[model samples]
Target: MKPFDYLSPGDPAEAVRSVARNPAAVFLGGGTNLVDHLKLGIVAPDLVVHVADLLPATVEDLDGGGLRIGAGVSNSALAADPRVRERFPVLSQALLSGASGQLRNMATTGGNPLQRTRCAYFQDVTTPCNKREPGSGCSALGGWTRHHAILGASEHCVAVHPSDLAVALAALDARVRVLGPDGERTVPFTDLHRLPADTPERDTVLEHGDLVTAIDLPALPPARRSAYRKVRDRASYAFALVSVAAAVEVRGGVITDARVAFGGAAHVPWRARRAERVLRGAPATEESYRAAADAELADARPLEGLDGGNAFKIPLLRRTLAATLRELVGEDAR
Candidate 1:
């Protein structure tokens, strides 16, 4: 490991100033992903600014029936909060479905959405990965691609974002509060992550010295009936091959409102806007669910690679989305 300078900033503004002054500096929160990258030689920052103590750690109720979640709140705490489980069950379920108990205990809400992809080529320094080094070329394009993107992919990169929490947030329309060198601002959670276009190395819109302070969940009543479902190779500790986070409001056997998002399908937590548009005011039936899934996946283009490709993810994602919508409407999802 390369030697580096460490700073435990007493204030968030101080932390921002310290990191903004030096582009080579990075803010450290929980050190779950960043530490691993440090040891793997993926990232070697000159300065590490610890912000765990500077950020808020409590979950507070907003006046309009929403919730203000501190960025420093652990995944375990967020999932276990009664308010979260009752008001936004999808978020809780999504958080619980990820990682493990020990990791959840240490992982912060702010840091969870900022996680990098688990693409094997991107992690192996010996391999050529566009995401690791932009112009070096993409190994996933011709290598193992069972976990790669099927939607919104470009020639530069096909890796998928690995964040269950982010999918739930995208469905809930949560907003992220960030403090940076330019000062404070709020960003829609859906816009937090950027698709890998020409610049595959940049994962998010966040700039240097930008610190996520908290996440704001809106007063979404439909989310009370929401749920998160993941289909993976294993029961635990495995990233989703296809995951769905959905919230539906049904009245008199018709869908009044709906929100849907998919994970492991694209470079970002893909908000199924087309599917949501189809679901609104539609009948709450399997036919309607299938239609919604079809509308969203009409343009999906799965890639071919050494591991026989990930063409299977397209159908698997369609089935997963349809089943999740069925389950939400109290139907037999099977």
Candidate 2:
């Protein structure tokens, strides 16, 4: 690891100013992902601005409804919070379904969503990875892409994001609050993560010097009836081969509203807008679910051949989406 200076800012403004002044500085929230990146030589910074004291650790209730989760809040705390568990069960379920108990206690809400890809090529500094070093070219495309992207991926990169929380948050219509030297601004959770266009090196749309402050979730009634499902190589401590986060509102056996997002499928949390369009006003049945899943996946651009693993994703996505909707509707029926 490279030697670096550390600064523990007492406030968000100070932290932002410090990072803005030093372009090589990055905010140290939980140091979960940042630390790993540092060790892997993926990132080397001149200074680390610790922001634990600058942010709130508790979940605050939004006056109109919903919840304002502090960026500094631990994953375990967010998952176990009464408001998150009751109002947004999908978020809670997604958190619990990731990593392990120990790691959850250390991962922060902000860092959780901004996790780097687990693509072996990206981590192996000796290998060529667009995300790690732009213009080097992506090795995962022809090497091992079993867990690569199937949607919103460019020819430059096919690495999938590894965040269960982000998929649920996107489905729940959450917004990210960020603080920077310029001031504070709000960005939708979906907009925070970007598709790997030609510039595959930029993982997020966040400009340099921007620091995540908190995450705000709007009050949505259907979120109370939501759930998350993940299919992985192993039951524990494994990244999802495919995952689904879904919420459905059914009235008189007919779907009134629906939200769906998929993880381990794209560069960003893959929002199934096409599926939601097909689901609304449709009957809460297997046929309807199948149609919606297919409608959304029609745009899927899966890679081919032995290492691609994209072919398997097609069937897995359908099954996961279908099963998730079925489970949500079944619960509503009872």
Candidate 3:
């Protein structure tokens, strides 16, 4: 690992100011993914700014029944919070479906959204990785890419975002509060991440010195009866090969409302707007669910060449999404 200065700032503003002063400076929350990349020489920041003391560590309720999750809140704490468990079970389920208990204990809400992909080439410094080293070329384009992206991938990069929490947040229409050099701003959770486009090096839409302060989850009526489903290579301690976070409101044997997001299927937590369009006002049936899922995945461009093996993920994702929707109306007293 490279030598770097560690800054222990007690104020969030001061922490972001330090990042603004040094472009190579990065915030340290749980030291989960960032520390690993430092050891692997994948990232070489000149300074590490510890922001644990700068952010609140509790989950507070908003005036209108929404939830404001502190950026410093641990994944385990967020999942176990009674309010979260009762109101947004999908978020709790998504957190628990992720890495082991130990990692979740250390991972923080802010840090979870900043996780890098687990692509093999990106981890190895010897190989060419557009995300790790832009303009060097993308090794995954013609390499082992069973877990790569099928949506929003460009010629420069085919990597996927690996965060279960993000998928749930996307479905809930959460907003991320950020503190930067210019001051404070809020961005929609779905817009936090950017497409691979030409700048594959940049993972998120956040600019220099931006620090996530909290995540504001808006009041979602359908979220009360939502669910999260993950399919992976192993039973546990593995990333999702295909995952769905779904919220459905069925009334009079019709889907009155629906919100869905998919992980391990795109460069970001892909909000299924196309599917939601098809689901709203449609009959809550297996046929309706199938059509909705298909509409969303219609634009999926599976990679060609050696990495084309991930094409199967398209069908797998479709099935996973349909099955999750089925659980929503499976027990209706029709």
lDDT per residue for candidate 2 within 160-202, as digits (tens), equals 9999999999999999999877899999998998898999889
Q: Global lDDT of each model?
A: 0.93, 0.90, 0.91
**Looking at model 2, which ten-residue stretch has the lowest summed lDDT?**
302-311
- lDDT string for model 1 (1-334, tens) is 9999999988999999999999899989988889999999999899999998888999999987899999999999999999999999999999999999999998999999999999998899999988988799988887899999999999999999999999999999999999989999999999999988899888999998899999999999999999999999999999999999999998878999999999999999999999999999898988888899899999999888888999998889889988888888884222
Each candidate structure's TM-score, on Cα atoms with residue i matched to residue i, is 0.98, 0.97, 0.98
Residue-level lDDT of model 3, residues 41-83, one tens digit each, is 9989999999976788999998777899999999999999999
Q: How many residue pairs clash per model? A: 0, 0, 0
> Which is the leading candidate under lDDT?
1
lDDT at 146, model 3: 88
Residue pairs with clashing backbones, model 2 = none
Span of 10 residues, lowest total lDDT, candidate 1: 325-334
